[model samples]
Structures are given as C-alpha cells and as structure tokens.
Target: MNELRFRDVSVRFGGRRRGVTAVDRVDLTVPAGAVVGLVGESGSGKSTLARAAVGLAPLAGGAVLLDGRPLPRTPGRHGVQMVFQDPYSSLDPRMTVGASIAEAAPRGGNTTAEVARLLDLVELAPERAAQYPAQLSGGQRQRVALARALAARPDVIIADEITSALDVSIQGTVLNLVRDLQRRLSLSMLFISHNLAVVRYVSDLLAVMYLGRIVECGPVDDVLGDPQHPYTRQLLASAPRPGGIPTALTGAEATLDSAEPGDPHHPPPGCRFHPRCPVGPLVLPGRDDCRDTEPDGAQRRHQAACHYAAHASEQHNTRSTP
Candidate 1:
C-alpha cells in the first residue's frame, strides 16, 4: 500500500529566471510505513517535491497521488504536514510551542487530547507543553515542530533538512525520535536532505537528483553500497574519509565518496555526465542507441535517464568497488 506517489511530476515557477522547472518529471513512491530519503544537494527540487506532495507547490504538470488518489483540489491542512529545516523560525515566535501544535488539530478532532498526545509521542514532557518557541533548545524546538506536524496526524510527512542545523549529537537524537515515531505510528515519510551519511543511516530507499531530475534511485543499501550511476557514486565519495588521501577523480573513474556536480540547463546530449565522465563514449557501445536523445524527467521510478544504464549496470556487475 503506497501512501504517496509522484508520477511524472513537475513544478515550474512562471516568474523570471526563465521559469525553471524545480521538480521535473519526478516519479517516486513512498511505500506504506517507510521512510524514503529524497537525498540530493540543495535546490535539487527535493523541497519542491515535498511541497508538491503536501500541496504547497502547484502541480505544474503530472500527478501527485496520496493513497492512490490524485491530489485533491483542496489539500487540507491536516492532509500532509511539513517540518521545515529551521525549527526556530518554523515555529511561531509569537505563539507558545503548545499553541502551534494546537493549531494543527483538525476542526472536529479532539484538539487538546491530540496536541498532548503528539507532544508525548515526540518524547516531550507534558510540562513543556506550556513553553514558547523561545524557551526551547534547537532539538527541543524541532521536537515541537514534529509534534505540530503530527498533531494533524498527517498521512505523509515532508521533512526538508529538518535536522541539518542541529549539533551532530542533537541530530542523532532527533533522527532517533523520527525513527521511533515512524515505527510507532506506521507513518510514511519523505526525509529530504543533502546528507548522504544520514540518508544511509535512516532511509530504506534513496533518490539522487541533480539540476532538477532524479539521476538515480533504488534501495538505499544497494544504491549507496554499490551505486550504478556515476553521479550517485560521486556523491557517496564526496564525504571526507578519515585517514584517506584527498584527491580528485573525475566522473566514472571517481569513487562513490567523491561525488561532483555537472552542467544543469544544457546537460550532455546523451548523458549529463559525458563531459566529465571517466568512461569512454559515455553512451557506450551497446548504449549508442540511447545517444539519440536524453530521456525527459518523466520516467523516474527505477531508471536513470542516462543512455548508459545498461553498460553501467554491466560495469557494476563486473568491476571492483571504487
């Protein structure tokens, strides 16, 4: 039972900047009771995809279905909730923390009981219920925000870099809280972040995005442990490895820990990584057919638009880990 699914989704702003398509033809699925990690760099449309899932961004094109239902015309406040990156600002500076959670209660729902219930669910003491946003620490503030989103008991939760600014220890604490909450409530979550380490730690599946489209995606362990996509491998390798030599390796030649960015607007004709690709004839021999044109963002579920997926897959099957 998939809780939320995005099919050929695209979100574009009509303002200046030539109306960039923020979430481009992203096809994704949040299986029931799973924490799917939408991992990528900032502005990779992770947040936009989250917003579209919860109805904050318009569905410029494609479908965002909740529980197999196409997004409703009016996505109610309690339908899908968002936990912003900055907890301090995300909470109402003027309102008490308890009040913020109270605001999320459905009109007919047991407002007081639900608010208190969520607060407890997030591991907050009953006494802290009266505290204001200014009275809490960063972690505490985030807990309150999580409580607020859960107050509505939303079916889907879109957490965009929610723990990014917190101390590392605090991040672990908060991540544990989310993990606990997900299990306890059997919730479906879309955890958006640029932190691959964290994603590797928490998510069941991962989606790697660049420019706007998702370049690669699959089971987290498989994708992170043995990435088939060059971009995915580069991203995994980018993190500073302890006691390891820091050297630059371009494209396919690079290890997963040394990820890199590529041209956005005008990606390579066959594959976006062709210019920086360590592999020869990026589209490769058998994949020469894919060189005719790059696939649009529309096909997202388990495919990379790259012309070299087959070759890449074959390489993955034959080569040693980088």
Candidate 2:
C-alpha cells in the first residue's frame, strides 16, 4: 500500500510578489488504501492540490510525498495519476478510446490487451475502445478517462470532481464504479468534491478546505456527524437534508450573510477566515482573537483549524461538569 502526503504544499500562480496563492501550506494525507475526500467551494484550491500531486502545477513551496519519500518531479509516471473533472475535454476528441488508454500504458508491452483489461476494469464494453470521445455519453467518457488513468498502474489516484459534470441519473453509477475499483485494486485516493452527500457516501476520511488551507479533517462519520469548525457547520447547514428538514445548526449561526471569502492574493490577517467566520466577530462582537491571531491547525483525532471550535468544546465540557 502506498501513502500520499502533502507536506506544507503551496502553489502560487504568476510572480511570487503579486501572485495568487492557490494552495497554501496544505498538509494532508491519503493513507494507504484509504479514500480521503477533499470538500470545499469552487475556488477553495481542491483542484489545485490535485494538480500539484500529478506535477501539472508547480509547487511554490513544500513537497508531495509518496510513501514517505518525495515524488519525482521529472515524470513519466510518479506512481500518482489524476482523473480530471470534465470528461468531454479531458479525453482527446481525435483519438479512439483504446488509443488514449494505450498511450498511458508502460512501453514495451502488449498495449492492446492492457487497454481491453482497463476498459473492463472500468466496466466499459471492450468494443467501446474503438469509439471516439464524441461517440460516448458523458458517463462513458468519464469511465474511459478512469481507464486511461488506471493504465498507468498508479498507486494513488487524484479524482478532481469526477462526477460533477455527469448527469444526475448517471452520477451514482460512476461513483459506485469508482468505489468498487478502489476496493478491488486497493487504491489510495484523494477524491475532490463540493457535494457533502456524495463525499459522505464515498469517502472513509474527509478534509474540508477554505481559501487554500485545510480547516477540518477526520473520519467522514466523525466530521460529518459532529462538525467542529463554524465554517464546517455552516457548510453542513446549507446542504440539502432528507425530508427537507434543516441541519443541527439553525438560525443566525447558519446564515450565509457573513462576509465573502477574501482575495487569495491578499488574504486577511490572522486566521484568514475571521472576516467570514460565523462564530468570530459576527457572534462574539468584541472578539479580536480571531482577527489578531492565527489559530494552529488542530492536531488530534478530529482536527479543526478554528479557535472558536476549541473554545466551544471547553464551554460544552464546563456545562457538563458537576
């Protein structure tokens, strides 16, 4: 089993002085054979992190490690492969599906057989290999993309919003195939998505990102069941619930009227999230701790990078005391 770790990874676009930091000091691990779902809003750096793993994006600082060692920057195959979000654009329009998968196969092998096996691995009909990208449906194209990634025989797969572009009716089928493939192949994955329900269904562990930093991470059940950070609670509250019932967080704290996330090029001081924090100045009024001091990323079984989460835990413990 291979473990993938991002050690304080940071990705900056353009010049260092005025560039936007897409991923900032992110520390995350996809444990051996475990699926870690990364969730956040569209601009939260989830995809940027994935790109960094595959060497598509240059790291401004830090390293991406595979099994405790740094991944090779010069890539043919660094034991990590990425399946991008848009199937329509990800697959080449001119190439046949078989040709696409075979192109990623290791050289000096029976490429045809490998392509057939990969197609079957992704649950595609073997004959579909001859079809062009335009000939396949959205879901089929995605499956082909998965097949192409698998052809590299990678230890870790970075799935960057792989299901978001598919039709709703076909999303479940694709997700199930991905889950099944992971178990059958004992693959470690960093699954990126914005859908809480989808992440809950597919991931064993979850990491929440906001403005290029991880705000919370833990076992999926623990984080989703008892979210620690106010941002996490706000995300959960806004998610659609079964039977149209509201989530545990209700009223003012759950409201989305807080300030919008700041520019990545010029993030706010201290916590970085203080401007939009529901439990900070918005609720506590005179509290400057959130604005004046950056909170360390919580280092525990279930982690949350918010001072208020720690304070709220202390308050709860005090109330429960004799």
Candidate 3:
C-alpha cells in the first residue's frame, strides 16, 4: 500500500491573469490501503483535484507526492492511474478490449495472460477482451476502465465520477465491484462523486468541496451523520432517503437555491460559499464573519471550514445526547 498526498495544490486554466482557478490550495491525502471519497456539486473541482494527482492537470502551486516523493513530471508510469467518468471515450474505440488493457501492462509482461487476469479480476468474462467498447454495456465498459487502471499496477487509483454516466441500477453493481477490488487488492483510492449517497457507500473518509476548496472532511460516518458545514448539510438534506424520499431542507439549510456559486475566475474574497450559505448573513443578520473572513480549511479529522462548525456540532451533540 502506498499513500498519496496533495500538498497545498492549485490548478489554474488559461493565462495567469485571466485564468480560472479550478482547484485552490487543496490539502488531501489518500492513506495507504484506504479509500477517500471526494464529494461536491458539479464544477466544485473534485475532478480537477483527481486529475492533478495523475498529472493530467498541471498544478500551478504545490506538489503531488507518493510516499513522500514528488511525482515525476515527465510521466511514463508513475504508480498513479485514473479511471475516467466516460468509459467509451476513455478506451480506444478502434482497439479490442484485450489490446486496450494490454497497452497498460508493464514492459516485458505477458500481455495475453495479463489481459485475461485483469478481465477476470473485474468480473468480466475473458472472452469480453476480444470485443470492443461499443459491444459492452455502460457498466461493463466501466469495469474495463477499472481493469485498465489496474493493469498499470498503480499504487493509487483515482476514480473520477466513474458511475455517474451509468444507469442507476448498474451503478450499485459497479460500486460493489470497486469496493471488492479495493479490499482484495489493498488499493489506495480517491473516489470522486457528486452524490453523497454514493460517496457514503464506498468511502472510509469523506471530503466535501465547495467551489475550488474543501469545506469539510472526516470519517464517512461522522461527516454524513453530523455534517458541520452548511454546504455539506445542504447536500445531505438533498440526498434521497432509504425509501427514495427526498430529505427536505428546513430553516437555514433550505437556502441552496437562493444564490448561485461565484465565478471561478473571480471567486469571493472571503468564504466562497457565503453568497449561498444557509447559515450566513442571509439568516443571521448580525453575523458578518462569513462575508469578511475565510474560514480555515480542514486541517484535522472531522474539521470544517466554517466559523460556526463547532457550534453546529455542539448543538447536534446536545440534541442527540441521552
């Protein structure tokens, strides 16, 4: 097992002065043999952070490290691999699935046997290797993408919304397969998703992002059961319940649609989420902290980048205590 660390990472697109900052000074770690799930709404930079880990996205600041060593800029095989969201686009359309997986095998390895083994590992039939991406269902294609990532023998795998494009019925199967593979292979993973329910199902740790910054992070149970950040609370509230009923947002948490997120090219000076924050000045008239000061990012377990995080936690504890 190998640990992957993103130290104060930032990703900017376009020119220096006019570019948009997709990821802003994020500090996250995928611990050895553990799965860390990064969750957020669309355009919140979850995928950008994943791309930074595998060198797909250039970092404007900070470094991506594997086992305390910086990743090589000129990549051949860096022990870090990514499984993209769209399987059809990720795999070569002209190549056989066998050939696609074989291309990722390390030098001098037996490509034929390697391809079969990978196919079996992902629960696909060995014969499926002879077919093309178009021949496979969305779910199977995603499994092939996972197999391709594994063929690299990577120490860390970044799965960027790998299930979002698939049908809801197939999503569960893929999620189960991914969890099984992680445990059986002892793989370190950074699973990115916009669905809190999906992230909660597969992650050991959970990190929530707003705009380009992480607003809260902690063990899955802690963060989901008692979300300290308002944005996290809103996400949780919007998630469907066990019987497919939507969890209604009430009081301060009901303001998710009151305002849109700020532009990435010119993010708000203070807390980026303040404009739409359910618990900010929109509800608490006298409170201006969210509009004036940036809350500290997650620096410890169960931490949240909100001035009222402690208060919220305390209130929850009080309500739940017997």
The top-ranked prediction according to TM-score is 3
* Candidate 3 deviant stretches above 4 angstroms: 74-76, 250-252, 314-322
Q: Tens-digit lDDT track for model 1 on 1-322?
A: 5488899998887764556677777778888989889877666778888878777788888998888888774555465788999999888888987778888776776766777788888888877878888889999999999988887768888889998989888899999888888888888888988888788777888888876777787788877776766667556656556665433554446532333455444444655555444443542455454445665433544556565565666775565446
Q: List, in order, the clash count of every candidate structure.
A: 10, 0, 0
C-alpha lDDT of candidate 2 relative to the true structure? 0.87
Specify the poorest-scoring 10-residue window by lDDT in model 1. 255-264
Residue pair clashes in candidate 3: none
lDDT tens digits, residues 1-322, model 3? 4999999999999997998999999988899999999999889999988888887788899999999999975444449999999999999999999999998888786789899999999999999989999999999999999999999899999999999999999999999999999999999999998888789899999999888999998999999988898788778767788998876655655555546778888898778887887667767786688888899954677899998887766765564467
TM-score of 3: 0.94
Judged by whole-model lDDT over C-alpha atoms, candidate 1 comes out at: 0.75
- Model 2 misplaced regions, further than 4 Å: 74-78, 243-251, 254-258, 311-322
lDDT value, residue 115 of candidate 3: 94
lDDT of 3 at 278: 62
lDDT of 2 at 303: 93
Candidate closer to the true structure by lDDT (higher is better), 1 or 3? 3
Per-residue CA lDDT of candidate 2, range 1-322, in tens? 5999999999999886988999999999999999999998879999999988988888899999999999876545449999999998988899999999999888888888899899999989899999999999999999999999999899999999999999999999999999999999999999999999999998999999989999999999989877787677668767878987655543555454344777888988888777776567756776787888888776898999887787755543454358
Per-candidate local distance difference test: 0.75, 0.87, 0.88
Sort by lDDT, best first: what order?
A: 3, 2, 1
